[model samples]
Target: MKLAALVIAAACLLAPPSLAAPWLRTRGLGRVINGTATDIADFPWMASMQILDNSGCGASVISSTWALTAAHCVLASQEMPGAYTTLRVGSSSRASGGVRLDVAQMIKHADFHMSTDDADNDIGVIQASEPFPLGSSVQVVNLPGDGYDAPAGLPVTISGWGATATEFNPVYLQRADMHVLDRDTCRDMMADVATVTLGMVCAGDPTMAICYGDSGSPLVYGDMQIGIASWTRPGCISTTSVYTSVGNFRAWIRDNTGV
Candidate 1:
């Protein structure tokens, strides 16, 4: 299929605006493929990108006032702002009850360039207008310590509100069990599409993949947030979902957010 068609198909799975606002009572994505529904409290750090009133992407709380997400989710250019107006954090339901904070600032990596065939340095940070009151329902996720590397074949969990099937976006959050793939294997798989960088981590199964609206969601291993949902093959099936490695960008995140 054409890349555009794939993108459109992926977008339908990732961010379908027709669905009810996540906070409101309305029903929900194929992008989460073969995943199960989860409770908001399970992943309290989860965030939703609210563009106008619609939830289009996912994010994670790294500190009381800081969130981590994908660069393409928040940057129009080095000088322009992203499409999202707010970061809805502290909720797994995508909507429902969560602090909807105005995005005080969006700091994408200076080296990030989306124009490339691959989304290089596809990571960014969001500063909330105010600190989130950390509690049972709201909390911060631990970033990997220095020199940390995810072991290949290590099982991990990914959560998001992306489509569960073609044109289906869920009202509640979803989770899938996946495993880390060796970088070389990931690179070869992506050679026909985009260049796979060391800064990226790859995971997924033929039965499960990340699709459109899932961009920016967290890939959790143990209690640490290791990856940010970046991209996957069009149709979101039988392809490895790529993530921006949090361990690779730990220094950058600390320098920018100081937490």
Candidate 2:
């Protein structure tokens, strides 16, 4: 009965939408990650996960009615369900001006265990109450397919409404460019902190890393989303930060969302 109940709950989350269809009509040249503020259209897939009208984590639209985010972002709300109330998409500013959608369901990874030191399988999918309007400022991002791998030293973009400085939250979206680090290097960097598992990807620059509120943000390479911001060193100023490997969980995502 317990297994049956868990299976029934997982079934309710459904699969994500297909990404073969293009949703974005325009692309901005401005780079994200450790950069300046971005226009709403700059990263159309970007979504803001909010609780009580305040932005708490970042997400990406996978379809009109589905989104991808960090499992930990919705962990607290899993039991209460009502804790997470809204998802704001198609906006660069977190404070205002976006299409707000009610969160109907949140599906976290079954293997996810927050108390574990590694934070393995930290991905989640969210179903919105309605489809997001497709336009120049709103769209879905492509996920990395099977066998797709991000080689170390590869540059990728990270975007979110996270704090620009310690304890300094920003109203506008910010982005920065970071390079993928090899597993060995990542393990070394995080040796004193959390365990860097194969299920996670590591990226960051010497001067920049994902800070508070950046959790669940996308790490993009070309047009494909490669990772989701999972955790950072205590100060968020570490030379490296870990991300939940989207490629590693692509099959799981497809199994859950069918996309």
Candidate 3:
């Protein structure tokens, strides 16, 4: 009955209001990646994977051997040991091309709290068995230099293997073009949460925003990646996506990832 127990536990996680339909809205503006089937040959750091064949997410290569993703994704990965788990990066789509990296270790942020939906420190690091190839189409995205503030309205690229609609993981890694939103507006939207700290930034539109499966998608501005896909409380349709602001926690990330 292990399988049955696991299934029941999974259902309990889904009981959160964030997982409900009212909070789930779909968008069509992003590029889609088929589950573990995208061309990331150019960005070996932007890997894709499926957790229990349900949630689809992306990873960022922080160091030569380590990749970063959301802690929520790590928790889901822990729940499902092996079920078509793979990592692909540096491609517009999973099918066309990309380098597939094998994971040797997964480290979730020590401060991560999935039960209370605390995404403040929702980051995780994945150590690949081997260093990714150093060449074209498979290089890591450089973290922004010191004191990099993500100015409002900068157009950034976000990609993920997340679902195109509610309760679905897209068949391809979806790439979307979005502009960064102001911090005050984002905090106002999540006013219910008394502690929306400086570590988070908001993005996406009211009708078309990141959804349930887009966790860990990078928010890159210019040549530096400044944020990570974190949460959608009011949901994807509410014009606010709480992101783990990399700029605010660069020291912490560097200390943990050592890169």
Candidate No. with top lDDT: 2
Q: Write the per-residue lDDT of candidate 1 for residues 41-69, one digit (tens) a residue.
A: 88888888765456666889999899998
**What C-alpha lDDT values do all the predictions have?**
0.70, 0.71, 0.58
Ordered by lDDT, highest first, the candidates read: 2, 1, 3
Question: Across residues 126-245, which tens digit of lDDT does each residue of candidate 2 receive?
Answer: 889988988999998999887466899999988887655422446788878879999898988777667888888988887667766677888899768999987765445477778889
Per-prediction TM-score, please?
A: 0.84, 0.84, 0.76
Q: What is the C-alpha RMSD of each candidate to the true structure, in Å?
A: 6.5, 11.2, 6.9
Candidate 1 to native Cα RMSD, angstroms: 6.5
lDDT (tens digit, per residue) of candidate 3 on 192-227? 643456777766654445555567777677547887
On TM-score, the leading prediction is 1
Ranking by TM-score: 1, 2, 3
Candidate 2 TM-score, C-alpha based: 0.84
Error of 3 at 245 (Å): 0.9
In each prediction, how many residue pairs overlap at the backbone (N, C-alpha, C within less than 3 A)? Answer: 18, 8, 32
Q: Score residue 158 of candidate 3 by CA lDDT.
A: 68
